[model samples]
Target chain A: MTDISAQDFHDALVAHKLIIPVGVPGAFGRGPVFEDVLRRFGDLVTEAAKNDTAEHMLFPPVIARRVFEKSDYLESFPQLAGTIFSFMGNDTQHREMMNCVHEGKPWGQYQQMTDVVLAPAACYPIYPQLTGTLPENGRLVDVQNWVFRHEPSPEPTRMQSFRIREMVRAGRPEQVADWRDMWLERGLSLLRRLGLPAEPETASDPFFGRGGRMLAANQRMQKLKFEVLVPVLSTAKQTAVCSFNYHQDHFGLLFDIKTADGQVAHTACLGFGLERVTMALFRHHGYVPAEWPAEVRKVLWP
Target chain B: MTDISAQDFHDALVAHKLIIPVGVPGAFGRGPVFEDVLRRFGDLVTEAAKNDTAEHMLFPPVIARRVFEKSDYLESFPQLAGTIFSFMGNDTQHREMMNCVHEGKPWGQYQQMTDVVLAPAACYPIYPQLTGTLPENGRLVDVQNWVFRHEPSPEPTRMQSFRIREMVRAGRPEQVADWRDMWLERGLSLLRRLGLPAEPETASDPFFGRGGRMLAANQRMQKLKFEVLVPVLSTAKQTAVCSFNYHQDHFGLLFDIKTADGQVAHTACLGFGLERVTMALFRHHGYVPAEWPAEVRKVLWP
Candidate 1:
């Protein structure tokens, strides 16, 4: 269990000048130290995944609304999705929107949906692009992109917008599963090498409502989602710093992805919540990077 | 004017396998080559700004709604802004929302405004942070973050969400203006060194409506905004790959940022649209980095 409270962590971040709050509760502008640590951490992650032979890719934060609609995100996690709204009104309607904004009324009513939506996950855009038959051995991709979720809290770890470094694989069932398992071990070892006490446990997404509870239970029962946990805020309530998920042909069917043998492809991904990992580092180690354990410093800075 | 039509660029992007459109018209998933080039470009920008002594920073794409409201974005460029909307309804409202989504009706009505909004520019979050008093010399910050704009277009250069690499300075009026001018020259030279035919000219933001026209004219009349143009899609029209702006205390007044002399600090910034620059490189050179001019390759790849 970590001895740090949420307030303590927040104060340390502010005092060390690592983060600047933009008067928004969960949003922040990170300082040089924070960016330095994040870049080094990303480099380490890249170093670890070099053997995976993953194709590196980059993506914008927003996705096409049509592609998003096809992802079934609206059905699974409507509560946490952020849809981009724009005012498409004519001059008169624009006047109404302006009036509402000036008068502090419900101005959102005048806004209409646009073609783009904020991406819920970094890998969402990747799967759609792989909608055809793969090579004989299938494919692996490494992506680092910003992701959005609507959870606004003062915990510092749960940011409204964050980056996720993900390795997504699509191949035969055995191949995909093996890759996921291999990364799980590799990920745990990497964090342990950094002196972070991490443990892998079965987990589930924050699914919506009553039906979602059953979906969550089924997901956990199948052990399809596993998260590497670290005690950031509390010992009993650990934060998930990394997650490994096996979609098991769900995406293959949606995107029509298939192996060379014409069988539906199996997909899995390992995601590291960059902000949470950084916060966990600050929580266990000192807020100042220089004060961290010598071994950890050597692993990261060296 | 370059003879490349929008379709020609799109076809070339696909032919070179640099980008994959994910069944969406404008949104794309970049490949390894694109990522490599973008990373190298970012490093070059960092190298160019080494003398500025700017503190590098990172920010989340979503910002506090209050901060965004205070920026007067709704009053100036509401057409290009995107507000994050999430489902905040009760279970009853959730059911209705589900019904609307299932029935193919507009269901955005169920979302309530969170404390956050999508950031329109990389520099918007920096001003509110420097709200108090600056040191004697004021401050300089380097920011590279993904920004969102609501423009939906078939033109490949205009992405809905893209990355912007920016250097922001806050100080006395003369100091800020000088920095902007110096950077304008520096930016043009850097692009020219890369074998890009670049030119700097007075520019203006795409302000909205009748009143916005005057605001834009006034901004241009004051010689406040300048952009480096390169012929990416068309030599006839060209594209603004980089921009330099002197805010002349506009942000200082809004954020209450003051200099050591007890006067409002003047602000300036130089912004390079990462995707635009990369696209410009591909356009001026060849689509393949290996086939690019040796001098350009050495500058970018070295």
Candidate 2:
């Protein structure tokens, strides 16, 4: 990864259509730089869509807790998730009793519960909606979602929440795998297009707690996921631009997403973190963004 | 205002690259749609920008709370803002006490106000970041931000929190006026392109208490704020997509942003509610999203 000055990186952002409200934060703490990188990503995803069956889509920033329960998230990955829970009014009233005991005040409110949670992953919604039916031949969905995870700390690359621009396909085994290949290739191509060098390597989600390590190890061993790795802020450990994952029939069995003829759908997804890509660009181009290769600028700006 | 069934609205969305997530509620809470609409609007502003000498710039999401305080927001609109507060070691101490109290008993932990509030608007950052420095030619910057406000009940067009895509320019009197004109025309043109029927009517920000009504009326009388009204589920009152506002020297005085030559930077902004535009699209095409106008589809998807 090349290092660019903060000011130059900022300037390059303004030059490109990569921007959002100055004070707006995506669910997972994405910053302005992420938006700039996403513009480049949107192009890459758009270009990838040219040959894939998927159509681009956007999901709500938040999802209902029931959706997760239906999909079995509470049992599988509860710790890495963030639930949006407002104190139920009854609980608030209970607290009001305590408040009154301490300082004589009656606080009133309505009913509330942990009814919703921010999306934990980009692919959660895909299976639920496509369940019960499958495309005649196959179906591909391109979606960009604000994803959230409950990590204890923040790294520039590993945002507790981030934008996951994904191209997902649910269909016959061959079709889904082929689509993943196309996207993986395209994802690497996009990294190269932006002037970053990346290596495709098996990767794992650093889930939560003790058992998660083994789960991650299993993931890597099975080659369930592949990431486009690029060096950022250092030379040894590289950052990932995109990841390709094959979820054989996991979602299919759970969601019952089946073909028109009634067979479970095979699922594969290509995921990209627009913010990581931007940080990679900053390291590669150095802080003076004006000096960035025209290739990167052209794809991003015009 | 027109009332379209949810299904029909969904259909209209699918018709265009307007693919709504299968189960996520409120696809309208997105900023991308707003960004695109503003892109079209910005094109006009870009043209309008030719009337001035200032260069284009963007901003960051987090603004210091001290800045908000200087602006008198606490005095005028405390209820309307989210003030981010951070947790120090106090929570750890509380957690230990709670654990002791609930030993051998069941109870949830209290972790309220552990973090800073998310930003409430886009403009908050600009005033503070630029307050200390007043450019000679006056500074004109366009900022977009995710804004949050507390509203108990949220409808499709209304949200407790949402994106506020603002195009703001602050500079010397004439220059700010030029920037304002640039965005005004651009905003109007964007509405036309989206094919939504709109009327520029006076508008007012929901100020505190009964004073809000008077301010609302004043907004209408001066035409200081213009709304791009779209009819919605409520036929009698319309939704607002675009708003043009003139702040005169309010922000300049609040933030102390001045020209290099020592004059208050006049300010004006054009705001677009991206979700509202999205809702307007749904209203126009019905939910069978597949049946939406081809041109709009071409622009959004393409």
**Model 1 per-residue lDDT tens digits across residues A85-109:** 8877666777888788777777878
In angstroms, the error of model 1 at B298 is 1.9
- DockQ (0 to 1) for model 1: 0.72
Give the C-alpha miss distance for residue B235 in model 1, angstroms. Answer: 1.6
- Chain B TM-score for all candidates, comma-separated: 0.97, 0.74
Q: What is the TM-score of chain A alone in each candidate?
A: 0.97, 0.80
Model 2 chain B weakest 10-residue run by lDDT? B106-115
Badly placed stretches (over 4 Å) of model 2 are A1-38, A68-116, A148-155, A172-174, A287-302, B1-116, B145-155, B159-164, B172-197, B207-226, B232-235, B245-256, B261-266, B278-302
Q: What is the interface RMSD of each candidate, in Å?
A: 1.6, 8.6
Predicted chain A of candidate 2: TM-score: 0.80
lDDT of 2 by residue, A1-302 (tens): 34544455444544453432222222222234555555766776677577654544556545655576565443345445554433233333544433542442321121122334566677777666676787687777777776665443424465555677876789888888887787777778878877888779989976444566888899999989898899875567677778888999888888788877778889988888767787777667754456778878787776
* Cα-based lDDT at residue B24, candidate 2: 39
Clashing pairs in 1: A1-A235, B1-B236, B2-B235
